[model samples]
Target: MMASSNAIEGRHGDASPPKASINACLPCRKVKMKCVIATHAMECNRCVRKSLDCTFREHRRGRKPGTRLSHKSGSSISRKGRGDMSTAARSSPRRDRVSDFWADSEGLQPDSLLSHQAMRGKFSLQNILSTDHGGNIDGVATSRSVPPDDPILLGLINQQVAMGLFEYFMEKLNPYISQLDPLLHTFPYAREKSSFLFTTILSAASKYFRSELYPVLHDHAEKLYAECFRRGEKSTEIVQAIMILTYWKEPNDTRAWTSIGLAIRIGMDLGWHKLRKSARDHGGLPDPEWREIRNVERTFLVLFVYDRSLTLQTGKPWMIERNEFIESVESWGEESMANSNDHLLCSFVALRLLTGDAFDLLTPHRKSPLPRLNRLLTILQNRIEGWRKKWLGAVGPGNCHVFLVQFYGAHLQLQLFSLPLQDTNIPDMDGVGDIMPFWVSYQNSMAMLELVTKYFHFLYLAQDSVHVMTAYAAIFLIKILLSAPSTIVREIETPTIQAISDATKAFVSQCAPPGSSCTLQARFLEKALRDYSSPRNHQSRPLVYNETDNQCHGKDGQVSVPDSRVEGRESSILSGLDLCDQTQDVPDLLFGDDGSWADLFASTGFNIQEGVFFS
Candidate 1:
């Protein structure tokens, strides 16, 4: 019995301790801590120490044997397949070679085998902590403080090309945008300001330079923007870069409104909407402080301009409301002559504010009928004229930038007055008792064409707005030709229409680059003209005769008469009745129908007299 008891005791002592967990419990897995199970319990050491339940999750990591990488190049799994390969496997002589030429030369990490997906998703904690404060981890406050010779920062383009593009941007494009000052945004200043801004400068100038790096540079800019947006990064340079990209955007890009809206939001977040009162009060501030404050204000004004123009074009609501920030343009004190662009910018902002007023007056959202449209028209006209006179006098009419701004003012006034003519409800001036709107719109269309023809080369530089305005002018004229009453039609000679058409064609062909949105506008204008000039469309209209002599031929030698086929017995009955007294009232009769008079005339021409159109 003693031997048996001893044997039992030895067996109990020899039994192994409870096996520790091979897999981590859920809590341990989450925190990436090792799981140490108690000798005789299911709970892990970590869970027990924390007084929590320990549960294991069934998950198999890594890949199954003999499986190839995923076919999807964008998949994280595929990237891991390349990154997690054993060093021995990578050293095989027969394996595909990795391209690390740039990696070695640039002293970057050996990431040649990594996909763009990996690089985009890869973020260093240290780098984030550094850049989050708008500086490097090494204590640089801003990229501007970094040495301009940092090759990795300008890795996308050659150093020389970057310098050239920076110079070109300041010279050729900056005047139009007026965001960058040559004195402030020098080559070194731009190159070291921000990588995103540097890429944007190169991309904006690439088209004019005809550089082959446009596609690459433009793509890089987009990626950088996406990364910055994802990381919630904000800076003045980013705002300026966004504006540049929006101005010279990709063809058919739908992001213009959204992007400009984002820029405005970001700028507002940065407190760019308010002026620096402290800087304004203190005269002893450093030069850089004054420059920074000026840049902030300039950015806000430019953003306001972009927002207004884009909202008008897209028919979207205004992003920036009309506040004192935009309204204070006129009260600004005289700036030094060295920053003449400031005056031009201020004038441009004021003119756009006037445009904003015009937009507000005509907004479709208004529930009430337009109040005294004529009075409103006069007020807007005076404002636009005053603006033009002030700016033209300040900069002299010869300045190209000032001329462009003046042209925009003219375009706005044209749009305002022409609003009545475009209304479907009030088809003709007879309803409003205003022939001036019709004639003025016609004259503006003509003048706009002539002006564009004279200075298309200068205007083409601002292709964003110029192309749209030019197309609008040509199409508006075509609208008049096709539907205007005989009175106005007689005034528009054949030579004039032909001249405008030729100019439109030349502008589209010469100025519109391939793959430009202007090409689509040009095509639409061409189609409109083609459809109107077709003989079939004109043949459908009825013919009518001049009254008095009953046989007096009009200048065009085409008699006007109600179409018996369409009007049927109604025409015969009217002809049979005594219509001499009614002849004087024919103008009112032509517009008696609530439907469009242009539609009425196109379907059935009037035979009363030349007096109808004159009245």
Candidate 2:
């Protein structure tokens, strides 16, 4: 029988054999073309070219020539291509696709398979990308566990002066960034909890440390910062570190713009923006956890202030949107809290809110008619002054100096709009009028100059914001000199101008250490003064009308009196304006397109995302 079977197989092998190409992908088979693929695992050329899902299946052996199929087998074969999809899908494919969700398994018991199947119930794209567990968002802890071998940790521990630097930060710098509780964030607690935060604190107070150690500390902090993001770590410490670094930003540093933005975003991710009803309404003596919550709230408010500051400085759009919770923060000062610094924070936040309101109010209507825009400006000014009247005398002790800088800073910020809005020929504006009277900004500039020059101690521990404020005042004074009348120009004693110039130089000196880039608003101011004295750029026209007899003539032949506050000074830099320079034709420095004050600041390369100047 074996001989007979072998002889029969040999005879059949001689007949036409089955084609192996039947396993080729459908697209290639439809075209009756060769399906070329580098390997069996990949798509064939034709399907790849068409961007189609290439699939192949094993072909069953053709029926024997003498065999007859039963009716049931033939009916099943007919139903294979045409049947209810659900019923058809219930059956396994002839070929194993090896999909994780549906591929058949062998060793697993039914219970185990059910457990495996349940794992995907909560699957989501964000969960898969951002969370450590399948769908458990909180599965990933916020407190980053510092490894013993972490370079940041080791560096801090090895430095004998690390604790000393931390003390310097707590003593000198902590007041500026009062969100951190000194008692809670003790040296050991901070060092052990987050190396990034510890390194940042040391870096901020590095002026007291060895000057050479600043870079090393900063580099370590930055590395840990990037590592935190890489590991998807979320915590209050990281956000505060970013804010601190941004506030005490390096010279020519552009990183603060985007760094603050990222901090705000991560803050939202941590739900800092969400004030739960229970979190807000908790009563009686606060628990330790509640204090932690309040600290978080304080940080959030500080972040908002930082955001508004950026908008005012760089003309960038703010990231944190206004909401009811933020709107109510101005009232937080009235609330009794265990921490005294919070009262100061409340006042600061209130000031920032007013500044933000000014930005929002005027930014959109910049092109609107000056009358409508001025109405909005007047409203903002009223609100700001109301804030001043209410909060000025109420500032906590020792906080008055900082509050004054910001108060005058707000005045400067509001006046900045005048430089752009003063140009009546600005192609976009609907009508011509000045919302920010020329005298208003002029007085604010003198006030700012007087404050900075008088306090002088501000330069010792001043943040970048204070330095920028000084620059704004100096630049505003210098630029207005062109159209300023000889009377007003003479009144601005050479000593005052020299003093203002010296103040700017002091700022550059303070912020620019060994290799850092500090604010160059002073350089531009010098350039403007030199150009003003040059023979070619000496032409001047009546730029502003000074108040004579406590009144001035408007363009409509109507008499208007300047603000009474403008009268107190013995000499005013912008007290009068009508200087005439006939030596050469010069453009209007305050209003002309090329000479616009806005153009001067923009020339400093203030792109936030690129970190241009700050980098």
Candidate 3:
């Protein structure tokens, strides 16, 4: 398996020839042949013979990494790649502000924002800046009070304070997603590798913990981050730094997406995605080189998962093609098992893969009638159940926290297929039972609801509590309970909904200060749930509405199905994308890919049966 061919290209169109450089696609590169773009040339000669899509995309943006931005006085500097990053300062670093959501609280009721499409909840640079906690806070205020050239913010931290934050990052945050744990922990040794990466980690830590230093550290990170990429995008350290920065501040940090894009391109440049062949050819490469290569391969796999996670909801496009291999992930899993060091990362990868599958199986393009979709759902569910059993066995019983949070995430992404079905008002959807049992969908939904209920219980206990997936599950339950026809919602006893709702409210409040980006979205979702589950609405219906109705209902008893189902302003396009914290913003990536990641880690011992490949 190799990197996903169905990946999302960088901000520019598909092919970014490296700055002042020309390169061949992987196939041509492998053969050591020149890959030239002749007039009307799409595929390199080798790719055409192999019958593979000739997608030679890379992240070489308008200016290659390392090229300094040509700054203009008093104008917003157009940094290469997407340098769109920032956030407005609320009264307190932790307080919510109106500009964050780009609307006044007066006009925007939480219930309405959620019940109507959560357009404002979509991940955008605007949201990242408008809600960011950084300063000299120009990204948020857009005032340009400070020069973009300033990379150092005095008093950002001394060696002692820096260590405290680093400790916090290592202890509190690292355990949940530790792919780059080794690199992160050795920052003291690697700072010279890239100061931007070092500062970005601290900045992310400060933001994650909601330290007042978030603004200063973040500004320093933004300045140097641009510089790092400007120097060159191919340095493996740059990719690592981008991953760390993304994990530190995401969802609202759209700049992470740009960096993520660069990392993907750089991964391609180093041939990190398709390494098995490279390994065979580089016979003389030293053991240390192989180890480095393996790590690079793993990093690429993680990024591949991240891309799948994002596209699932935000409806963001992908760059990798469906035919790209995914063996890389498998290879890492196998290697990691020997040491037990990557047990958590394996779980993390597996959970996202399930979500990626769910996205592919359920996305509208399949035009898959309800019956076919149900069958796919069942098959995928069975696979997930297998993965869960294997994951628990691999992680062990003592590591209950890892097992539970990841499994909760699995339930959220897999069962999410039912939500779109529940909310979709497609007539003849009721006829779904003829092809397979209709109860299957409801059962799955109930399973998800139950997971949310389970998650609520574990929320207080799970260290490094992952909120985004939990939030997704919470909203899933709320949406079903709120809008689901009476019959289906009835199976969920009022007590269950009440408990879930109560738990959800507490969950939102818990995340408020030192908050996650999804807090407001959660609050809005909770409000919607409250409005729907209110005594008036519940009692207004005499008996459980029969599941016979194919239509998804609106506030009125009238059947109303939106044209696009649950596509817009709802979530990642591809679920527009998280792995760790950054990918969850695109966790849809962990959920779907063009098959490149599978190729990259193919020997990791996990593979979708050939018959199961969707699209």
Candidate 4:
């Protein structure tokens, strides 16, 4: 069988001879004549001969043709082109293109980014770039917490002392100030140090002033005044501080008053010379000018003197007698008259006389002996009108109008307080005719009211202390509302009152700790609101005595309802029976209850709680 098969193989081999060619590896694509397809793997004999790298997979038995071979290097090569190449090349270019498009569309240039970058580097850009979602990068930035030794804090301390809120502010700032020595001092005159001190003092002063901590404020102010005097550094700020302190203190001490007097004299002396020169150079107070700078100085002197007089009257251990102050004002008026300055003289006399007797005589029951408020109002109105006309051509009419408004409001307040509770009963003086004519000058009254309201609003808003401003504004609004006519009240809701309430609420919500200055105002407002709103005549009981009949009240001592419950009501019968009863006074019946009487009285002012009509 083997011999026969060898003879057959030899014959077939001769019939067809195989081609002689090198087998090539799939990866290298190189062929070699000595290449062995199976033992050398897929690599050609040439790659094997040259000792080059070959990443070809060995064919597996029964595997489908054209399938990817299993090899680590082949997998890596396939992933390289598909995964990383395009991405690596395209990322930077795409970002640059986007940035460029954004810049062009938004009108931003490359230079802006560069400039910003430069500035950022100088200022440490890391902080600027690290913004959270809130977009409040600098919102958390803190002011330099003033050191205890800082001059600014010292100034603030002095101001607080003046404003009477030192202890309160100190308590609030205790954590910070406690760490500092009382005598710790910063540089003598470094700008930052000075500014810091000044700002702190101003802030504290504003806070204390608003809080209405008057006692501590006055004490602090006096101390500061003395310190400034001792330092011999009487700059404008110091002088102003002293002036404000004097105003607030209304100092009764002879020495303190004398010092204030001296300060005033010094201010006057400095101011008078300048004013005289200005008048001389500018041609005698100029056209439409009613008062010169000298006049203003004199006005301040008069006001200060008047304030001192009031202090003497109201202050403890009153130094100056009321009669003596009145005499002095009379003399001042005479002097002003002698100088032919009727405006100043009139104003002086009017204020002095009005403030003394206006409150007592103007009320419903008290009789006034002084010039009737109507007369004063007339005089003021005429004067204001003249000034307005004269000054209109020169200065704007606004200032003149403002002056008129202030005078009007002041006079109105005085007059309102002076009026009898029943204004209708007070007959007009025969010669005066109807003073209502003057009072009815709606244009003037409205203008003045608007101006006064604005000023009050400004004060209320600008004040840092909620308690102080709220109290003051409340009082002011009360006074205004009380004096305002029913029509006026009906026409306008006080914006100042609303603002004060809102501001108080806000401040309380923000800065007021559990027990704080703001909380007091809040409580006050709440109480005021409640008190104002409670119903009048809440205590009055329905009259039922006359309605009790024997039939309704059975013999068995039990009450029975009638079949006609509506018509048989005993209360209605009693009301009719009591109507003509001469024994009862109508006024007594109406106002018998305290609630009714109190509500009647409360209607004169803003009763926040009741929301009643301001009569």
Candidate 5:
């Protein structure tokens, strides 16, 4: 039993520790008996104390094949390696030799093979980055970067610049275009890049040049034209630029005429044949595309060819040869089949510019040379009158009601300017007829007067009345006195003059604010007296103070004391003191006791007929 116990102890206790051998770890190959992963420095306390290799075969009994193979390197099988070898075997040298024979016989570069392979690898990398990695390192993003020489983008930017330049060019060149200098700094680069920017700039410079910049603008325009022509870009756009330049040139320059002629020739060559044919066949209306082209052509033609002041110069009428152009225009109108609105408007503007003074020249002739002018004027007059009636019916009875009133006024002014100044007694030309020249002028003047009065009335009634009223006071005083007719002057008998004086006194009292522009007001009142109280008092009738009262008292009825003596007493008393010495002969009712007509006339330096002279 003792021997058996000793054997058990010997077996259990260690039996001389079994020659303490080292077993390298399959993963680490370090000196130790305990497993030592390389990540743990290939050492364990138990192996170090035993003085054995701190190594152990990776535990594989319960682990996966992949885990067991980690310690063996190439000792394990690989499906991918097996498949690759199989593929190589399938594409062996026998097959490659046949492909090489065909490829070599073709004499193609063998480097293409390597290049294609490299390209495939690059494409694969790009696809991987773009699809799987969400990176933008590929060439697609960089391809969209704008280049300085790109034609399309440059053209678009140039167009934007052109639009801005056209709007502000005149301001840039003319110091007087605006008093504000800050306006110039607002848009600088926009003016530099646009093609049409030079046109507007030259236009403004020509329009407002203070005689000093005339030569400058002229030289600039010439240089611009030469540059465009030299560039071999004498397109329709270049022609338009030249035409605008010519328009702003000195009116009498031979070069101006030559430039205009060249521009017209170029324009006609571009498409004027089709334009003229379309205009004639279509009756001022053509297909939309053709019409747009025609409109641009006509705008250039109008700007280049026609000058109203020049047309009116009798000595140089033939210098411009306006009659030929007018004949052409008339023929174009007759041939046109479709009448477009734009064409009609352009025709109206062109005709007015061409024939404004021809009407006057022809009116006195035994035979009218311009029957077509008469017809065109009649048509325009009717259209304008119809439009005026429509607007009048739509608007209310306030000053704002006349917002569109200027359109009618301008049309009438054009018509009046178109009338002949000859003293012909033609029935149609007489002021008594339905289409009478004087009747139209009178109507237009009346409308303008009404508008002026309404505007002043608005100022008087408005809440913030100071500034607006001051502006209107100057405008109204100027319009009323300056625009009234000589006929109206003659027909205002003593009664009408007296009534007007009373109204004037009332109007003046309302404008007593010292800050207003009262100089015009004072001058108007002085002029009215001087004009109405002259030797022509026999021709003048006093203004009617009240319409009802004037109507009730017949023209031949017994005389009533004029309302001027009663209504204007206070204003005349205050204002007459200043004017008493100069206006003593004028019949002022302010100086008399009880404001009697005779006493006031005697005391206030009143004269019945020899009117006051303010100046």
Candidate 6:
């Protein structure tokens, strides 16, 4: 039913001699259509009809053999040069071409990585178009111009607070959350910068401001966050801002999850995740440019760690896959400023690795098990301990964030081991020894509770606790205490939990502009603790004396009898470890292996050694 070829061509039959189809012009290639250029035509038919110029541009070569080269690059010689007239000129061109091929060979590209990242839109040029800021920012076009408020006036009223707030984020929250640029010491040209980060910093710091100004500061932050996001400006600062705002969300709420994912997507488009490799390509860049590159790396690291931690927490599958840049976090070195909290970043990278591995070792969460649970746990603990030893050596007076993460990672190790506790099929009736070695995970849990106190003690002396870390520590401690026997809690540790709860409430009090997510989380945890400590929550019944009854019944129809004979709740921290039968007794050799470091701490008591930061 289709028209014959001659019939289709009747109108222009022999007007121009039939010419072989050449490579598609750039305009046609951009839209991915065929090119039809007559022998004498200067432009492709599509461009001729559309009244547009037909351009041809050289592209970077594709790596694979038989790779689809740009249409015009199909032959060894370009169309214009195909019939070379001069042999002497050809030889000179050949030498230059060979030299150019091997030039700038310092950087390495993993061929395997390209294909993998490609699926995630790694090489798309669409991001290149959007990265110019104007294309990205939507809705309100005013952002394309200067801010409505005069920069001079905005700075004047908030100068002292703004500078201190930026430092606060850099110090107190940044190490814990890891979002701010490490290089920028103060707010630099705020009116010209991305309002998102500026407002977010002010909003976060607003919680700590005097009550009179809290509402004003927080409102300003909220408006800017809304405007910047609603009208997206393509800048890396947008990514930074998204991360800080995510921290402001309630713990476990998916409200800000989407925003973070967007930030990561934009970050990848900006090639922030690939900054290290790209930076390596251009050696001898200025210090400011290098700092910008470092900022991207640091920001990407923060994004990676936060994304993974939340993934692990929620039992959701990971969004970003592991990559080489993340692995290089440990080996890469920086000449950090004095007390720059650089150790925290290094330790954090190491800690994130443990969590990434934790993702795999975790049952069902990971696809399959390679190293057995015991093997995995021992490896992780030893590695974490190694990390602690390294970071502790460098700990300054203001190292609370690093200290918290050390214990937090340790807690996560045990927490991973206890993942089976969540499996409904696994009975947790006489909880003490059923799921995991109750005494062991319990010790880590107890140790975590102690660490919470120490974490705050350090915060109180040096800096304030970040809401996210505090909430995480709160979640860890509460999970244990929700069912734990009141009697088993140390007389000393009990007061610490109370102190945490009290401090949380005090934080709640100062949380201005109302409904601050961190303060709300603190209030919720405080109430939960208050309920747990109520008189009615404690068990009053005497233990049954029946010979057949092996489990001791505790509060609210639960059992707390400690026994080491239990199986499957294996002592994965170290192999061949057996606990002393008594509930209160700890083993002489904590891991049953010689030189178990835990035993040294047990013997010496869990006290912070002089000049030692953390064990």
Candidate 5 runs further than 4 Å off: 1-235, 242-274, 277-295, 301-362, 367-380, 383-420, 424-435, 445-487, 491-615
CA lDDT scores, all candidates in order: 0.53, 0.53, 0.44, 0.33, 0.34, 0.46
- Steric clash pairs (candidate 6): 137-232
User: Which lDDT value does model 6 have at 203?
Assistant: 63
What's the TM-score of every candidate structure? 0.61, 0.62, 0.54, 0.31, 0.32, 0.56
Each prediction's total of clashing residue pairs, residues at least 3 apart in sequence or on different chains, is: 6, 6, 101, 23, 40, 1
**Candidates in descending TM-score order:** 2, 1, 6, 3, 5, 4
Candidate 4 per-residue C-alpha lDDT over 505-564 given as tens digits, one digit per residue, 9 for 90 to 100: 333343332233334444444333223223211221111112445122223344322212
lDDT tens readout by residue for model 2, 447-500: 676565455444556566765665556556665564454555555534334545
TM-score of 6: 0.56
- Per-residue CA lDDT of candidate 6, range 1-615, in tens? 111232223223676523223344434543446666543334444544332334433332433442332332222222222321212232344443343322211123532112222322343445333223212111213335435543225652466766776677666666655445456535664434666566666666655544455456556665766766665444667777777666644223344557768877877655555433212332333455445556666777777776776565444655666677777775443444222455566666667775666645555444334235546656666777777777666545455665666666656665565553433222233543343433445456555545644554443212222343344444445444433444543332344354444444334333233344433444444443433333223232222211233233333344433221332331211121111212222222222222332223223212111101011
Tens digits of lDDT, candidate 1, 342-454: 77777778877766666666544443344576667667778788888887766634546665765677677667666665543223456443765666666676677666656
Tell me the TM-score of model 3: 0.54
Each prediction's RMSD to truth: 22.3, 19.4, 22.1, 36.7, 32.9, 17.6
Residues 377-426, candidate 3, lDDT per residue (tens digit)? 67766776777677667774443344454445554444455534532432
The CA lDDT at 337 in model 3 is 23
Please report, as a residue range, the 10-residue window in candidate 1 with the lowest summed lDDT. Answer: 606-615
Candidate 2 backbone collisions, by pair: 251-517, 252-613, 252-614, 253-614, 254-614, 254-615
Candidate with the greatest lDDT versus the true structure: 1
> In model 3, which runs have C-alpha deviations exceeding 4 angstroms?
1-155, 183-185, 208-210, 230-233, 248-252, 255-257, 277-291, 321-325, 336-341, 348-373, 396-416, 419-466, 493-496, 505-522, 533-615
